[model samples]
Target: MGEKESEKLLFWEHMRTPIAPQHPTLPKLLVLLILFVSLTYLVYTLKLVSTSRACKDAPFSKTIIAVNATASAAAVLRRGSRETNPEDRTDLRHLVFGIAASAKLWDQRKSYIKLWYRARDMRGVVWLDEKVKSEENNSDTLPPVRISGDTARFKYTNRQGHRSAIRISRIVSETLRLGMKDVRWFVMGDDDTVFVTENLIRVLRKYDHNELYYIGSLSESHLQNIFFSYNMAYGGGGFAISYPLAKALQKMQDRCIQRYPALYGSDDRMQACMAELGVPLTKEIGFHQYDVYGNLFGLLASHPVTPLVSLHHLDVVEPIFPNVTQVEALQRLTIPMKLDSAGLMQQSICYDKSKSWTVSVSWGFAVEIFRGVFSPREMEMPSRTFLNWYRRADYTAYAFNTRPVSRNPCQKPFVFYFSKAKYNSTMQQIVSEYERHRVPHPDCRWKMANPAAFDKVEVYKKPDPHLWDRVSSEEKLLQSEEVKGERDHGDRCGYV
Candidate 1:
């Protein structure tokens, strides 16, 4: 038995193939390890490259690079903060006004400039076509006078337009060349334009002076806007140019003027330049071109919900108040403007439920009492009291919607002009008085009580300096409710 087992084992061992040493597998494992390492490195390197590209495409990439290069991170943050700081707001000191007046009209128009211009607090120049006579005793009260640079080189091809449009347009470029420091805005206006300085600052502050902006308004006349441009900022109404925009304009404005010889006015030429720079008009309804004739009552009484930044064509319109000189009327208006310019001309509608009467109070201006309820929507539309700029044009030619002066005796509003306003210290409110402006109306047998019964309309309001801040939400609510035809009876009723 032992011999047979030993022989079989020996035969099987001899027949079986000999196995290779385990050492060969070491090289294969080494190759796999090398591949794994290379793959890991490639994956890590690709992730780094992707991160770098992401950083490069980021908006604050420059800020990050600046932070990395020896500049303290706090310093970089501070620079960003400085640009956005609320305290660094646009102010009068940052503005340089360019008032366009001819030496011929300087005597008459300079008085208008004196009404708003504060030489002590403002930096500006009165650009006259020629040197004004030295009869002005107190030159200190006015902006420093400067004769405009000659524009004889510029060609004006418009047969109907004044060639002085070329001169006026260059006032901005000339003002820029004066090398005034820290100027952020250049506001241009005709001598007749009366600015509400505080409100102008409020508007200018909303924009970034470092960026480009062209701020003003269109003319009230549809014909004027269509004939000139819907994109133009009317010069008479006054337009503000951001410092950056003005600088860009200074570079190309003369060339721009040359290109537009056929343009009718200074504003159109300016608009052509703005178009080249790809800027559009940023309209502010408060700046009134007032391209109309007659009393400003209709427009002022229902001013759009914004600060009244300026009024142009003052000489053309009747004095704002009855029986007062234009200058005196403005002085009276400024009283309320000083108390609360934000609330000035802001319309508020209320119901006198006891009398079943509707009262629409245009704070700081006028009040109108109607015998029956009138929709705020109707009251918001300005009454056609003023004539269109083109005497031949009718109400249909207006840029805005206007309601005809009511011919219905029953529907006529008893108007009251603002008489005086005083602060009631104990109540912490402003008590404004509006005396009834007596006008004869045809008698009607309508059952509604007459608005003429009331002699004075008294409005008590708490001076809201921040009224505009709340206007957006309140306007939205008003619009929503008006649309639903379910506006609450007490909504926007009183001072509260």
Candidate 2:
């Protein structure tokens, strides 16, 4: 028994003392394992923090930059020494353009006209223009602008004229350099196209400074011409450029100018360069670049159409301005015209004299009068029910006759009187009752009579007498069955 107790005490002591590892490398192995895990965790944490900060501080994802290329040929010729009007030197905010004199006169004229019109319309919008004229004849020499550490030159061969796409590109580059801000968004468009100023302003106002670049108004034809290998095809009349996108374009411009100088005629080529530089061209609608002649009318007629950015009226110049001005002036007029009784009688006689004519004749007169006096809010068909309910006589006598019948309170009648007896609700009911009671006379066929002619007649129909009784009987039966089922279930379960 003493030996057994000693063995128990020895076992307890063995349990209390820590066991020494048989392999000396075990402790070292454990220490190394722990150190490795700690180092890995520390490295991972640092990397995560660094990545998070880098993402947080990044600039706006995209910004809208608008570039206009519609400066006059004269403006282009005076590029080198173009006078900088102290007043014209507003901090070049958001517009860019290139001017060149030696290009084809036709192209220059078209571009110039478009540019001037757009500028006039986009008075409040931000834009930039690059002077492309020669400094030789001009007295003023503005500070030289540089791109890629080189003095940018707007060069054009005199013979190539409008056919020379190189000069146009040079003008575009000069404008872009001057207009681009540190912001991310950008736009490039020709002068001839009409831009909705309010719509653009509204979009820019809501645009987040940090987001992907968006190009508006993509055309399928332009897309086809662009090589997808470059991953760029924002085809349309105009496109927006992000700051990152702009930088990418600037980087690729030199290479593109050298490699695909022939592609300069197409704006899609410039877009392709951006694509090659890893800037994505987002396909978004809103930028329209087609010859939109009819679109102007639709835009003007729109409910809240505001300032138009650009309008290209190749023909009929005075119609837009003069008509718009006249309408505006009319809107400000508040003249109150009164018609004399003699004048009303004469108008009524004239209308009555033409009553026998065809519907087209009647409609023509109505439309002419409508156009002259009242502009209908919009085109829509007349409501059939309303027209039928208010007879033409009632419309002429009461609705259209705006004048008071009499000045004295006692002189006016509560009800109107007419030569043709007025048909009212009381007269119609009696006729319906008479018809219901009549049996068919074999010899005399019944003809529908005007119920309005008769008065003080009442018509009544009997209600179904058995409906309520039948409903009550069904309800009682359903209730009784439900109660019986509940009792049966309870009895089967031995809980009743």
Candidate 3:
């Protein structure tokens, strides 16, 4: 065969195989199908690979350094009036009392180191022990050191009496990196905080050391029209920071300290620095920064009982004294009851009133009823005005009378429902009432449900019978005064 003819025949033979389609769209369709499959396979492969470090143990299983910054050494030595034992100066338990001192104003140089060592025997939870150094000295920054398998080296640097919280933070970041190269978390706190070891361990177990960084309360401040975002370091209340975040903070410490020099006096500013580093800050309601007083029971109930990490007592007197042992025992006993009651109260609000709403034997039942049903939507309706009279009248006449008012801040608003059989009748009554008068019947707009929709309905009895005794007496007094006024008016008219 000729070269040109053979070349042309070869091309036609390759193209004319069974794979060649007579239809124009079939090849295009097949190409698209193959491409789609290739893309899917790529995605599946990528999904199986995890990008983060996979530590087999708990995130905070590694040793942690707890740094406490106090105001002065004298404050540590002299127990305030609120101190449980004023005379026992040498006892280590007495050091927990100093957690509330105004370390900002005192000369903390000498005492901060002493208190750090004493805190080593803090309950049964000991993560690490390192000498506490005062931030007062102008020493070069050091890196974290590995002391042992279980114990890591740590340093508590006191920022020398409220000098600058920002500077202290920079010092803390620098100190944390000096001793441990791969610390899972770093804890920053004040002397006044009571550490809950078990709870701290639990929190640490939730995330990896690298994935987690900052653990605290998320807070933002609007001061003088300037909005500042900061995390409330439960860590400050004694929260823990992942090592990655701690290292990042240490690297940024110089820049942060220089940029916000005034912040050295503020704990929140130090946390703001961490936020700037892109470290995720997890806020814990369990870690409280406020004084323990008015709502002690409520506070204890709201927080986790078994895994409490720290308690910051700003008051001079210990709210529950007898040191750590007494506090632990009390918490163990009270926390469970408080949590149970809180749950019961939550369930009570959703109780179906159509069925018997037997109040639970617990005192929390009433609290739950108030929280779940009445409190949330009490003020939802608009006040009555002539222009918006319909809305006001309908709400006042119907919704208010049916649902109880809630007194708890966290409770959801109450709602009333009707059964399927009664739905039409109830709705008809509401419509009839609305047509005849300006105000509609209170039960008019309740949502209707099928009888089988609910497993049960609970009809609540009237709240405690004694609740209105004082109000009733006051009303009687007012009525008597009105009657007397009317009689005096009649007598004057007769005399005239």
What does candidate 3's lDDT look like per residue over 1-496, in tens digits?
A: 8999999999999988767447688889999999999999998777655432343342543312111213322343343322345452222221111121233422332232232232344311221223333453322221122121211122224354344343335434544644633345556555445444434544554445556466665221112012334444533366666666666776776666556544424455566676677665676644555422222322332222223445554333233312233344334323322232222111211233443221111122111111222222222221121111122323233211122322333332222211111112433311100001121223313344222222322332223222212223346788557644643332211000
Ranking by TM-score: 1, 3, 2
Taken over the whole model, the C-alpha lDDT of each candidate is 0.85, 0.32, 0.37
Q: lDDT per residue, candidate 1, 69-130, as tens digits?
A: 54544544554475477667567999999999999988888778878888889999889889
Using Cα atoms with residue i matched to residue i, what is each candidate's TM-score against the true structure?
0.80, 0.33, 0.37
What TM-score, to 2 decimals, does candidate 2 have?
0.33
Error of 3 at 11 (Å): 39
Candidate with the greatest TM-score versus the true structure: 1
| TM-score of candidate 3 versus the correct structure, residues matched by position | 0.37
Model 2 global lDDT (CA atoms, 0 to 1): 0.32
Clashing residue pairs in candidate 1 are: none
Model 3 off-target regions past 4 Å?
1-161, 218-235, 291-293, 304-307, 314-496
lDDT of 2 at 152: 41
| Model 3 lDDT, full chain set | 0.37
lDDT of 1 at 120: 87
Give the lowest summed-lDDT range of ten residues in model 3: 429-438
RMSD of 1: 9.3
